[model samples]
Target: EKRTLDVWLTVNPADYDGRAAALLIARDVTERRRVEAERARLALALEQATDAVIITNTDARISYVNMAFEKFWERRQSDVLGQPLTVLGAEDPEIVFDMQKTAMMGRPWRGRLRHRRRDGRTVICDTTGNPMRDEKGDLVAYVFVQRDITRELELQEEYFQAQKMESVGRLAGGIAHDFNNIMTAILGFGAMILEKMESDNELRHAVEQIVTAAERATNLTRQLLAFSRRGVAQVRRLDLNSALREMEGLLRRTLGEDIELALRLDPADCCVMADPGMIQQIVMNLAVNARDAMPRGGRLVISTRAVSLDDEFCRTRVKLRPGNYVHFTCSDAGCGMSPDVLARAFDPFFTTKPPGTGSGLGLSTVYGIVDRCGGHVEIESEIARGTTVHIWLPMVEAVGEAAAPTAEEETRGGSEIVLVVEDESMVRDLAVRVLSSAGYAVLSAADGREALELVEKLEGRVDLVLSDVVMPVMGGLEMAESLQEKYPHIKVLYMTGFSDRDLTERGRRVPGERILLKPFTRDALTRRVREILETAKKARTHTEAEPS
Candidate 1:
């Protein structure tokens, strides 16, 4: 031993003679070192990410968090290191506890979670959490990733709303086409009866009442068509202020005394290209919603102003374009909403109220009208603070002129040999009764096939073909094409419950043509028939007069 067998030492004697030296020397640790380095690299990567990343131990205690997590929680890394993740749930700790339990069981959880920011404001985040395990497959930790999906949610809601409107439009067009035909007969008969009696007679006055009722029905059908976006839009550039002023009295009556309705209209001419009737509907629907919100009675302020939106505005708000606009604001001092409710307010059939209380199509219809008119709607609401809806319509370069009144003579027309075609028996009979009473020789048919047969059998005496669009045994379009081919001089008046585009697809043109909507009044039917027949007569005369 004193001689000390000469052992060659390449390094320190202490390093070679460590307590665990034999075991450490027997192992090759290069792969182990690489694995550890990779794990650390992954941890660092997660920590530096912008999305808040958090890891909790199996006991639901905070194990690790990235820099983003620290900022999101507004806590220092040291403070949150060993703290329970439930600490982040100042408002509701159960949310974190539940999510941790789900993840610990090897299950993943995803949902919107509410958390209190450092400033005390509520922060909503879309969160996903999954379980983590060690090499032995033991439950170790939960990894959570959270993102602010507020804007994304809003866009999704808007997309859903658009789809809903499209569906409603199709339904509305179909109903209007059928309803218009019934209206035509009702109105036509009422007009004929009224015309035969003395103005002072009680029976004549009763008939006048029928005509008035039919007219109101006609207006309703038109509204449905407008909602469906199938009705012909007579869009004109008009001042919004003047329109609002005219509607003020009507709105006051409609809202009742419970609501204190106030109109703050800017005198500046805020011109927009839109149909007056459609605009009226937009205002009425918004007012109705405002009234519903303040059921207990509150201030409803309606204001209109000129706004010039820029790119900044467009970026901040969804579905809005940067341009000059006329903004209509409807504000109500009612029970406000959480962000969740506000996001879905425009969705069709989505209502906070119990069933049978609301259809939830009010706002959806408004959105459709605005979208169809090349405008956008924005809503702002806070719980207990009430709501504000802003509708922005594009400004027009020119103002619209006042509508010209029809001449007294033009409104009156003569009875003509009218050939009426309709599928519905009730609607067909109504047209026959109404037209016959109005002093016109009317022929009725249950379908287009019967109508064409009658037309073909009758020698050159048929004046006009009043046909329904959607019918069995050949539709109105096909019938019209067949008749027009043989009798080029025969004028066709298409009546339909469907939209103009629907008929156009059947190889028929509606532009400048006398296409009547169903459920029309006696006055409307007689007037339209007269106009069509007169126009046809004029055209035939013009053709004959032209040089060959």
Candidate 2:
């Protein structure tokens, strides 16, 4: 191959020899040119790379840093060229020592580290260091490639939190399922005993208190279910003002005289689709949280209004949509939360209060309830300033004339053959007592399997089956399915504390399945049974009257 050459001329000898001759020397520089081009290519590649690149001498002194490193470290190249590599990210002494030892052996070291930037901000990064060797095979330098992984770590934390919540949900759901059965017996027997007591009897008041306490216990379990996202919401178009009004006295009593509980009700009705009991629980939790935050007493303001959110407003927030919404706000002038505390306010079992003082599910349950109701909750707080929680729920028109419950209707009952299926002995006895007192022939079973045998041998005479959804041997849904095949005329009612999602997962096939929650009052149980029995009788009469 032909190639161009670098040439040099020697003319001094010609001058000395009085214009005699000149000598020329030529050398090929192709290899030198190719090496320079390769070096340039590598430098350009390092400059444009996204991951940070740093070069340090064997002594751990920084020698060169790429553009990416300069930006990522928030420093100029000149500022860090002669500094120790430790200045870049030696937060963990052990990690740095391990990396140094590994690099010295001409090996590679990789790790995730919390590194401090030049600007003093800490960041999580995935970093790798490889030893660079000279032609003699002696280590000369160390090359480091690092990537900012703060967002990745955050995503991983969120995923872990989600997994944790799911685990907590399952655990809470299971506990609540069994606990509900126990509470049912407590509340049911309390109500039944109180019903038989004379109004003037001294024991009547004590019995009434027992029933009240049982109801409160039931409420607590429901809150736990809410945190697990397994609690069902009985939604209604409710006036926020009315609900708050009803809770004012209870809230006042709970907050005590030192804390001022103020209600800023809207002039116009603030109607939203929500579960009334769940909404009350939300207010109760928030109020209790505010109370705990202000041990010295502070002003707690509960307000409601109708607000219109535009697309622009919705764009800046998550879990929000542009529409008219009922804005419910609870603001408290109490010791506020730090950024760290606020960030994890919705994490289950995460609490700032002393152990046993709080279950730490207050805010998490509120978050779950608002989310389930197609709403969003936003919280704002500063270190010393107070905190304000803003909840926005989609507004709806006021529902037409809701009939108030009368005393007569509350105690109403019916004559029907009702089968009660529950695994708990106390709960089964309570159900039998309540139904028998309500003029119904009540049959009891310890489990669904036993209930199935009872219904089968009863020869289609059972008018309704009020059964617990979960039990040993067989579940309520399975037994109900079997009953449907054998005695299609029988009505079924499923009572459970499990979430709707759980019910579906357990293969609930009854269309529009009716589920009455646990710890239901005697009146509630009797009224529901009568309603189902009446509906069934009317259906049977209609079917008989129809041309078959």
Candidate 3:
């Protein structure tokens, strides 16, 4: 009988005897060697791939790591090999333990796992691990594949930012639309009253009150525009300390006799790059919030100082740039907020006050305005300790003195024919009455389409088109375009209850095109209408003088 072996064998016998009966035996091993070589090649290929490849023994000790894993850890394979799987930088140690237990149980584990980078930065990664077993079905090791998705996360963040901006724009537009309508009614009615009232009479005083109310409503619309980033910001270098000092009287009146308003301005000049109107709004809103927090009498301290924030200050803060800033601090000795409430305080429509008592937009508006102006905000509060809000606006090099108030011109009347287009019958009637009493011949239209027809029929006789921006059927913008094409001589004045962006596609208000917000008093309506008519008349005279 021949002794058979798996590999080739050779026999050699120098002296053949009873002791050396079977000299040598050899069998072919080429097939088995080739098979083993093929397996090794496949394993090497998988290990060296760009995706992170790692192998761990059944005990969860790391056995192998490929080039990808080595690069990911910023270490050589020798450093990671033989290390426990937990040492491979899983952010959550429990996660690694859970995965090892599952893999040891002969089940595959796969899911996202957060891991720390060589630089100590944390990143989320997609990970999958499968139990590797021998032919006898005993667990040998676990193979893991990981993919870095930092870029994917960055892209998602960018997408979210775009969506947020779009949503904010829409919200601002809607608010402006409604506000413009209300202003239109108020202003139209006020104008009619002013036209019929005799100077220095009881009726005149009532008309003045109506006008004041309308103006305040106008201020609110402007605030909405500021929050929406659609309002025209007259940016100038101004000392905040001076502004606060000037606003002391107004703040005292606003907070009333119950609340104590205190100022703690730093002696150092704290100049900022901001719109004076917007700054006032920010101060006013914060003060109002402080007042609300203390339904009973409380102390409100408004202060300003120059601040220099370092890198350490920015680590725990969101959306903050480390630099010098003019810090406006508003502190109130009133009911404070819990951690949970403080977290959501800056979010729009998130209010702690009872419904109808607050709009919840105050803080959000302040935040938006500050952010748009390249600033940051920090809030500190604890239950029963009261709250302090610190707003940091970027400091700017002072170039000029504080802005001076412009002189108000006397009310002027016009004789030009003006077309008034408004959907609301009451508003339109009031506008017609005001304009007629002011010596301007007015043509009224219920909507843009009606106004267009009137303009086409009247042709050159119409000097200006004062139309409501939002109306049923044809909108004001479309009508303006149609009329402008036919009669280039006609000037346009857009009126709306919404923001200026409602009329402009990209939030840019056209130059020379007057925009009047709604809820305006009779005086404002009359003043704007008179101004537009006079400007049109002046332009016409100038054109005639130009000699075409």
Candidate 4:
């Protein structure tokens, strides 16, 4: 209906008629201009879109693709246009067919789908498609939008896994705490009976057996606590190479002659801050796992090196930061795991080994330990190839070195006064009995509140406070804090069955603070008390000797 017109008017010169002539030229460009404007708008929209956009004809052949689509598929638009939709390689052909069917019916389709890139990598996408129609309501084409959701899906899985583990850990921690309380009484009474009996007495053997069994049970509880991330870690600066070398002989014996064990230490020393025993346990667990994987006989390689992870490398991992790290790797040439098995590898009590053959706690324990130490773990495996596990622990600039022990035999008992505070009756009784037997004057209380009252009444007479960290109405840390303010000279030894995180928000082991973990042996209890008493005595003596 729109047109461009050019018109001219001419006057005829001549005598008689003085005629006027008009000439006109008209051009219609309504459809051409309209199409040009639409093309420009569509091109701009496609060029600037963040989501992958694809336009396919009614026949399911690609008519056009946006820049985002090209980037996503790693393909050129010129080569892909007019090709079949199947060229994108749908992860599930049925899903693609269903989507096309729904769109052809003039209905919209939305779902999670996978497509393969030109490089052979598959991408997970939240895809949506809608049919485009002409003014007469006739279906012409379908427009699809896709957004990459690979990382989002990974994060979601991690979140759910963490929640499940946390719930399990809470249950495990409560059980371990109660078990420790029961075992303490069992072991303490058993030891006392054995100590009173004659060397040749028959009852002595029975009591000794009970004590031994309790010790074994204690080991199981410790593992439970470790998996719950509640066990206190005695972290120290470590030379990973030295530890691995020391473990070599033990590993060989454990592996047997059929399996070969190889150790390749980093040329540069890899130093990390971790519990020495725990680090050893990590290596041992991994090696044992590898040994189990290669039942028929295979080569196991343990290697260590220093590594630095950057921002990009750390992005996909949860709770990981970019920094210097010590890398420890354990690889086995054995039967590998399937993807389904690999995804649940770190879940608690998830094991493939037959009944009683595995506890399903080994890998889960490893995950908990590494997570507690501010480290990360990665696993890679293929069906026919092999499995490799990589562990990274942050590196620190400096760590305290332990002093060498003196050769002199020191007494393991002392006459210092100790206040025992615990809510658990059996555990409190055990502590009282142990300290009393070790020549120490022991005062007992049912809880921190009672301990505080006793301390107040004792008025500087109580030389040391040995209190449980958790209790009703009050806790050891609170009692200790009050004591420090009132009687700064008094030494406090806090004990707990709870994990380090429960004791402190930071989950840090405070320097120079004495803490004893529960379910301890009489000897361990006596030795620790003696050490703190002696140290306190030395400090008091030094203060008195100072000139005013």
Candidate 5:
């Protein structure tokens, strides 16, 4: 094998006793050359590394810095050389001292570290610092490795916030669903009592107050349902511009004369598939909130832009994906929120308004609506400057304008057989009383399985089945699927506590128009049942007249 040999040579010539003498010496320095080469390579690698590297002496004074470190700190190496760690504005003096102590003890100190720049900007990094020792075990220097993780930390915070919001939403939804049953019973029985009471009765006013309170309570539950994403949504593809323009008049009126509403809509088509009512709720809630903020005169600008988000644009936001979207913004020149208040803006029941003035579900409902539509919402505000809320809704292909709904037919009492299924005894009893009083044959069951058993024992014709959505043993949707297999042509209607969309049996869906919402008056209960039967009768007549 060939070996590299570095040599040092010296030659001398001298005259002694009139005679010339020459002397020569040579030595190999291969190992010394190899070590020097290695040191140069290591230095070069550190200088070119992406992560910032800093070197300090045993006393914790800055000795060297890589190019990356200079760039990360936005300073020149000349300015930082021979300076203490404090020169970097490390924020916490105690933390720095502790880290140094750990490093001096021949242990690595690693974790998230924050550095404050002169510009008042914070730089969060995943930092690791360790002491370097020589062969004699003497500590020589300390090396620090820091990777910028500021953006990553921010993204993690957003994810945690989203999880928190989801948890609160689920809690609110469960509570609202249970409350819906109580409201339905109260409203149904109270309305029936009022119908029988004389107009000049002494107790009429008290009963009316009770009914009014029930209605208002029902509305509060509705808001809670919205925040939980448990409200009914009849979604359809519609133009965003038209939806806003239609609401312009209402928004202006809601904002009052003090606040001027400005509509700056994009000329391009901004079509999106969404519930009209949900869209209306989003605008109205934001408008009302902005109006409250302004108290005095101010400008409220509502604008939309058809934007195409690329992968780069969506990378920072975990909830967003790259696609065409309508960038809807509502900005108001009014007193803005502080950082502390903005942090909890999407939390359910979190409000800065005085008690009884705000239900505190407005912004939370806005977030839930956007989330339900597979979109994202963001808000930014500064004290005394203004507040701007941005929403991104996915765009859909253009479709024709939706047709206006037809007028309702007359509601008339019928003698058809009706089956009502409900888990709540109060709601079930109220439904039975209301339908029986309307002159219809009624059968009731506690749950879907019980209803099926009742139907099997019946010998008469069952004209319609009205059932609640959620129940023990068997749910309404599962029972409906089973019944349809046996009696395919029997009329069926579902009444739910909240959210028709949330009802599904192994991914099965029903028509939104067929599902009725809870907290109905006595008249609504009878009227809806009659309407379904009437529609079924018309369809049967039309089928018979058609050519076979």
Candidate 6:
């Protein structure tokens, strides 16, 4: 085959004996030319690549940057040509040192990197830096490829935060359940003690003090339950805008004269299904945190808006679902938290204050309340740059006001057969004694499993089943489900210290389900039992009266 070969040739006229002579030299250059062309093609590809690419000198000074790098850094190639890598990032020193060390050792470095842009925005990047070398293995330059993963990291953080909050909530709920069971026994028996003692009894004063201490413990347990997302809140469909307006004065008074409270409420009613008191508590908690943050006084702005969270918006949030949301934000112009502090800001009992100054449950309670309402919570803070708490509650159609409690005449005693199922031995003993004293045949069981066995053996018809929501072996809901099949006519009265999502949803309760929240006084327990039995009696009478 005939072929053409590119060659380098040089000819000079001159030479031998001063006569006409030519000296010529020729060498092949085809491979060198082809290699140069290939290099140019690769360089162009890198220039247009989606990932940012930069070529730096041995000292890490930028020598060249591709188009992608220019756009990603928001800086021109000309401006950054002679600049050091620090011009693009004030990254963690350790990461930079490690990357440099690996590259200097003639190895490629790959890692997650923190970078900065021309606009001063922080970015996270998955970066790979390779030490480019000549054929002789001599180091020439450092070539780096970086993919911006800032948004990805944020989404991951949101997911992890949701998981952490949920785990903590479960722990808190468990603790509250245990505490509530103990308090139920203490308060129940104490009430029984006081009911018998005369008004002038000397030991009655000591017993009153004991009851007072137990009541205080109950309040603490209530707060813990609130943080656990299993709170016994009296929820109602509330308009966020109007609710804030009503709370503005309390917030202002709480902040005192130095701090200013501002409300930028949405004109459109932002209604949500939440406990009115819980809503107040959430706002109050945020306000108190803001006030403490700004000890020297700063502006605390609380804003609300009706927002629709689309799939894209909800995708990053683990617990959040796409829907209409009431966006409630509390922002403060004060000394904010550092990165370390911000990470654990939502943790229960995590506080930055001096000893005895804070309990650290404020934000956690807000977290639980929002979680219970099927909402999202986010806190953004930077040292000396202030803090902002963002809460998104699922919006609900405004219904009529919270239903008023049904009026019924109080009952002193009842002859109905009552079955009490409680896991705590002391609580069970207390319930048995109280119900037995109330002139009823009270049956007792340790838990759902035992209760089922007890029910099966009983020959007489039990009028009501008083069961604890949470118990060992089996839960109240499971027992109730079984009861529904076996005894459809028997009435059920559920007693719980904290809320149970499995029993019923957090906000909405079943219409006819009767719940007695602990630690109830003996009178409250007896009254609730009698009420359910009486209602059942009327129901049976009406059923009999109806023509078949």
Winning model by lDDT:
5
lDDT of each: 0.76, 0.82, 0.77, 0.80, 0.84, 0.82
lDDT of 6 by residue, 26-54 (tens): 98988888999999999989987999998
Between prediction 2 and prediction 4, the one with superior lDDT is 2
Model 2 clash pairs? none
Return the TM-score for candidate 5, rounded to 2 decimals: 0.82
Q: Which residue pairs in model 5 clash with each other?
A: none
lDDT of 2 by residue, 230-323 (tens): 7877777889899999999999998989999889988987998888988998999999999988889989999998999999877545567999
Q: What TM-scores do the predictions have? A: 0.71, 0.72, 0.61, 0.86, 0.82, 0.75
* Candidate 4 stretches greater than 4 Å from native: 1-35, 100-106, 115-122, 190-217, 398-400, 404-411, 456-459, 504-512
CA deviation > 4 Å runs, candidate 3: 1-51, 66-80, 88-91, 115-122, 157-179, 187-347, 351-358, 362-405, 433-439, 452-459, 472-475, 481-486, 498-512, 521-527, 541-548
| By TM-score: ranked, best first | 4, 5, 6, 2, 1, 3
lDDT against true structure, model 5: 0.84
lDDT per residue as tens, model 5, 275-320 = 8888888999999889888988899999999999999878766778
Better of 2 and 6 by TM-score: 6
In angstroms, how far off is 467's CA in candidate 2?
A: 1.8
Which is the leading candidate under TM-score?
Answer: 4
Q: Superposing all C-alpha atoms, what RMSD in Å does each candidate have to the true structure? A: 7.3, 6.0, 8.1, 4.7, 4.4, 5.8
Candidate 1: lDDT over CA atoms?
A: 0.76
